[model samples]
Target: MANIVIDRIRKSFGTFEALKEVSLTINDGEFVSLLGPSGCGKTTLLRIIAGLETSTSGDVLIGGKSVIGLPPKERGLAMVFQNYAVFPHMTVYENVAFGLRMQKADDARVKAQVEKAAGLLHIEQYLDRYPNKLSGGQRQRVAVARALAVEPKVLLMDEPLSNLDALLRLEMRAELKTVLQSAGTTTIYVTHDQTEAMGLSDRIAVMHNGVVEQVGTPVDVYNYPATRFVGGFIGNPPMNFIKVPVTNGQVAAGSEPLTAPEETGNEVILGLRGEAVQLAPLPLGLEMKVRVAEPMGSHLLLTGSIHDQPVRVVLPSSETVRSGDVIGLKLDPNRITWLSPESGKSFPAATA
Candidate 1:
């Protein structure tokens, strides 16, 4: 395992700055994910670490040694791309052993390591099958096995499960985590999928427009987002932002007044997760005219508008509200977030 450190890395493509003095540290044996939307520089940062893209400035260190001048092969790291990229003509065993062969390991040692990695990935039974004969998940496992066969200090994955179906993606996620944990390889995974990042990472670095927006554990970033962009980006159904007029420690949504703990001198945006909005029995509350109601197994997703602003609410499936229903929602101040109306900077309430 290796500790990866990126110190003030900057990269530009023509006039576009891909990475703007981005800095982060991945501890030895830690699984850290770089998460953001497309064109947000998460992939560029990964490629820089893999030596596939050169940084305009700054340093990349592996195990306390700078690898700025090293080639990808000499960097002592393995990378897996979005596609499986397994050779269709090669058997699973051959694909897994390719890296070891490139490094000129003895035939006996290569066989042992290949068998061990395949077993670890639970693909040992399919070792003799060619890629064309394997399932999508099996092919993905072969790709991972090939990377593991190198026995590198670190592993880099760039949206490795994107090509798989939802069920297969979830299955591979569990399998990949197990294999990586057993091997104890330091891993840096890049993805735009917030759920995947939250489920797989020890910590996530949320990026935006070539800069690091927030870097924290999933809970920290979710519960106490550093910016409105993160609050809006990292959640399922996403967080709802209502632009409200602030006055005397209270914010008003249309004609209804909602209580929050933020000072009222500045115009602030109110943020509430879909789950935090309570469908209450009160007569007068934040009024939302439901536009669509989707039953998602255990819960119902209500997409509607509050004074023409979009709002999503996740309620129990048993609640029998339908489209075009005007419902009163009780805002939970304890779970609410306040952000600068103009800057979108988040200000979380203090815990008692």
Candidate 2:
């Protein structure tokens, strides 16, 4: 029952608001990622929960107990920071046993806990090795091992893998999920990388402008974003947004018109991901004037325009396309996400 409930959490730095009345609930044993660009307050929110920073308002509860005024050490949670916090003077075993030892745990108890944690992190073989003898990834595992040795009610990680190289980060991402899932601890991870968030989290809380823009499973967030900001932020190249006119709950797409579920305004934004575009026969689909065709290894990323709006479409690399060429593009109307012009809120099941 190590669920966390964040109630109207707000934080301000004198004149600036870092968090704006944000509320979210993380279920027991569920992994939730606080995802956003830099300065969006993801790390601040995590620090508040960890009792490292004080919120200007709101209460934080862990396993139903209010933890607002509790010190980090009393919060029954453990944290792994962006940098590996392993002690150079200590071996892997000693580092993992630090927390247990600090609790005045006996020799046998410490050994058992350290060994268990090391095994879970796959660092049991390196128990006798010091930090200097370990690679970056191995050192990170030691930090995670130390946190897990204490068996926290909640595990908070702040970009723990960001410092690793790209290949190592990819490898650790897969391994981290396995280790955490086996631990089954309620975890809150803060990261700016969408791939990391989508890959590691059971649910993602996408933040923007100091507030959570949307919270959903990876598939839901990717395929069906809740806000214009979400659709724009979640993808690698981001979503392609075309401002279109809405008349009588209808908007023109390509060969057909798309109907809006609700009346937003005379103008609405239509969003499409790169995966949603396909090649179509000429005159039957919309024609895009190609600006540049980038070789994306598996496909050609055609940077072009449709109806005078900037568009990027993915085409099969086998297709012949050049900077001056025009490609026939067909889009699935059902996959289009409609966003409001007034509030930028996306309609329900907008992706469908």
Candidate 3:
């Protein structure tokens, strides 16, 4: 296992700055994920660590030594690409043994290592099958097995589960975590899927426009987002940003005023999660006309407008409500977040 370090890495594709002084470190045996939307430079950062892409400036170190000048093969890393780059003509066993063969290991060593890796990935049963005969998840397992066969110092995965179906992807997520932990490999995963990053990673680096916005554990980034962009990006249904006129510590949503602990700016955006909007009633309430109600198996998602501004709320599936139904919602001040309109940074809000 190896600890990977990236120090102020910058990359430019002509005039387009692909990475703006990005820096992060993956500790030994730690599972870290680089997560962001497309063109955010998450993949570019991953490739830089793998030596597949050169950075315009900065340093990369593996196991406490600089690898900026090293070739990919000499970097002591194994990468699993989005496409599951397994040779279609080779059997699963042959595919897994290919790396060992390239390293000129003896037959006994290759067979032992292949057996071990296949067992780790639970793909031992399909050892004799060709890649074309394997399912997408199984093919992914073969690719993982091949990477593991080399016992790389660091493991890099680039959306390794993207090709799988929904259920298969979910299953593979659990399996991938277990396999990586058992092997004790330091991993850096890149994905655009927020759920995958939250579920699989010990820590996540949230990237935006080639810059890392925040790096934190799942709970840290989810609960106390450092920036409005993170709060908006990390959640499903996303957090609602309400344009309210602020005076002192209060926001006039409508008749009911939303107040924070201390005064923010003259015009501050209120960031509220859909789940945090209470549907019943409060002494001070904001009326919303329901535009849509979606039953999401466990929860009912309601999209509505408050004073002509859009709002979304999540209710219990047991609650029955329909479109055009006007309901009074109590915005939970404890869960309310005050954001700067210009800078998009969050500030504390008061809860009575």
Candidate 4:
């Protein structure tokens, strides 16, 4: 395993800039994920690190050596793509051993390595089966085994779980963590799924518009987001942002005064997660008219309009709330997030 560093990398496709001055340091034996929306340049940055796509400027270093002019093979990195790029005619053992065979490894060594990798991935029983005969998850494991057989210095994965079913993806998430930890390989993963990033990464780099918005541990990013974009992008059901005026320890929406910590201005966004908002018996909190309620097994998703503004809240399944009924909802001040209206930057509440 080797440490990877990207220094001021820039990439462009014709007139469009895909990555701009991107820089990050991935430590040796650490699993880091680059996460963002579809067009946020996460994949582009990963490709640059893998030496598959050359950056227009700046340098990429593997184990403290510059690989700017090195080809992908010379960079000593293994890449697992979104699609399981296995040969249909070849058995799983052949696919896993192909890399070693290309390097002219002896047959005995290649056979041992392939068997070890397949066993590690728990696909040893299917080693003789062709790709067309295996299931999607099995094929994915074969892809991973193939990448591991070469024993590259760094492992790069570009949404490798995108093709699996939901249950299979969950299973593979745990399997991947175990496999990588046992191998002690430094890995960089790129994905648009926030859940995957939060669950799998040691550190997450949240990217936007060809630039990194924030980098932090999963809990830090979720609890104390550095930017409004990061806060909005990393949560399920997203965050509920309400425009409120704050003045002298008080916050209000239109004429209704709400409770919040003291602040400097009269214009700020009050951000709250759906799980933070609760339905109350009293009519003292924010007065919202429910538009719809979706029962999601364990929780109820309440979609409503607060003074003509759309808002969503997640309530317990036992709470009985109907559509078109006016309800009182409370926002936990400790759970509230504050964002600057002009700069779109997050700030903590004075008491929070």
Candidate 5:
């Protein structure tokens, strides 16, 4: 009943558009992350849903009813921000109790909800301490505990772990996923970190330049990106791109022959993950003049020029190749993505 449907939401700040007719749905008890680089309007859309910012056009609905005119509190949702937004003067217990208190809940209910939220966030031990006394991670827990104490229909988190250190950020990221799923609050999270989005979301809406480029499960977005931007943006070291000529419905990469994609064109951009390439024998269509070799514990990454495009490839660490070596590549034909060079959309050459 708490499912959220964002229906063609648009937002503008004078001459600049922040969200352009973006639409998405977050099922009840599901976690959906708005993910993209900075300035993609993810946060703007989140704020619009929270009613902290109004949409210039379009509607927002929760539980199948439009909430366009509702204030944030009236919409039955809670938001956790990147800054941890805790009051310096209040003890953790009081902070967690604030939302319930605002609702005029009885003291007993407030105490119970605050205690429950603190337990969920694992901050019970520090409830009596002020924000200044807590670590960065602990302060964030207070912020989350405060939000959860209200038992909202939907939870919106905006980069809530960004301020933490790298290791702490990882820890909190996993913890948030587990805790939020347990709470089952129908969460919508906004983050520019792909790893965070991948780890925390049931689905991710990838945004770009005020528009959602794609919306899919983490696996779908990673393995079968909808746009060329998404294919290059989602992966670590990212998906590689090289323009190759097509002849007789087949791709001739320097010397190796690739089965033609279903899309009819004289040329198609070959999208390959670095891990998809394997060292093979002669007749390779592309040549990488290795200029950099990185030993990545479990794998080796080589970066160089191939088909006049800069590319990186991953290989098993045991491989002995180094800079100046020309490693022949045999691409896993089934693993390749065929993309239209003109429109940048995938050619649907393969099933998801």
Candidate 6:
């Protein structure tokens, strides 16, 4: 296991700047995910770390040693590509043993290592089968076993689960976590899926436009976002933002007044997660004409406009509501997040 450090990394492609002074450290044996949407420079950053792409200017350190000039094979890292790059002609045993064989390991050593890795991935029974014979999930396990057979100091995965079906992906997420924990190897995963990052990583690096917006646990980034972009990007349905006016130290929105922190700006954005908005008794809340109501299994998602600004609320599916109906909603002031309109940054809650 090794600690990986990225120092002041910047990348530029012709007239386009792909990365902007990005830096972060992955502690030994920690599982970190680089998460963002497409065109967000996450894959570029991952490629740079793997020595597959050189940075415009930066230093990459593995285990406290600089590897700026080393080739990918010399970096002592194993990479699992998105497509599960296993040779079609090779049997599972041969594929798992490929790295060791390349290093000229004897037959006995190769066999032992291949068996160990295959057992770890629960594919020992199909060792003699070719890649063409394996299912998508099985092929994925083979790819992972191949990487693990080499005992890499750091494991790099580039959206390894993106190709799997939804249920298979969920199953593999749990399995991958267990595999990495048992191996105790440092791993960095890159993906645009928020659920994958939230469920799999010890820490998530939220990237946007080639820059890292925040680095923290999933709960930290989701509950207490560092920027408006982070707040809007990290959640499942995303957060509802409303620019409400402040009058006499109280924010005016909908049909209610929410007390603002002292010394707040004239206008602030009130961010509300879906769960924070709820149906209420008719006499004491904002009245909104429902524009859409989506049934999501256990919860109902209600989309409507309050004060001409869009708002969404998540309620229990048992509640009766539909489109074109006026529904009363109560906002939880305690769950509200205040944001600065000018800078698009969140303001810390007032000191009580």
| Better TM-score candidate (3, 4) | 3
What lDDT does each candidate get?
A: 0.88, 0.89, 0.87, 0.86, 0.89, 0.89
Better of 1 and 5 by TM-score: 5
lDDT of 1: 0.88
lDDT of 2 by residue, 1-352 (tens): 6999999999999999999999999999999999999999999999999999999999999999999999998899999999988899998899999989889999999999998998888898999988999999999999999999999999999999999999999999999999999999999999999999999999999998799999999988998888989988998767888888888888765676678767677888788887687887767666788998898889888888887888887777887788888777787876778777778888776443
Worst 10 residues of 1 by lDDT: 254-263
User: lDDT of candidate 2?
Assistant: 0.89
Shift of residue 99 alpha carbon in model 3, Å = 2.3
Higher-ranked by TM-score: 1 or 2: 2
How much is the lDDT of residue 181 in candidate 4?
A: 90
Candidate 5 wrongly placed segments (more than 4 Å): 254-256, 284-286
In angstroms, the error of model 3 at 155 is: 0.7
- Please provide, for model 1 over 245-336, each residue's C-alpha lDDT reduced to its tens digit, 9 standing for 90 to 100: 66787776434676655544546677888998778653656788899999988999999988688999999888888888998887776777
Off by over 4 Å in 4: 252-264, 348-352
What residue pairs are clashing in model 4?
A: none
* Winner by lDDT between candidate 6 and candidate 3: 6
**1-352, model 6: which lDDT tens digit per residue?**
5999999899999989999999999999999999999999999999999999999999999999898889988889998999999999899888999988887999998888888889988999999999999999999999999999999999999999999999999999999999999999999999999999999999999999989999999987887787889889888678888888888889764577788866577888888787877787755776766899998988998888876888777888988888877887888887778888888877885433
Descending-lDDT candidate ranking: 2, 5, 6, 1, 3, 4
- Candidate scoring better on TM-score of 2 and 5: 5
**How should the candidates be ordered by TM-score, best one leading?**
5, 2, 6, 3, 1, 4
Q: Report the lDDT of model 4 for residue 335.
A: 75
**Cα lDDT of model 4 by residue, 232-276, tens digit:** 898977777777766765785333465654444777777778888
TM-score of model 2 vs. true structure: 0.95
Best lDDT among the predictions, by candidate number: 2
Choose the strongest candidate by TM-score: 5
Q: Report the error of model 6 at residue 64, Å.
A: 1.0
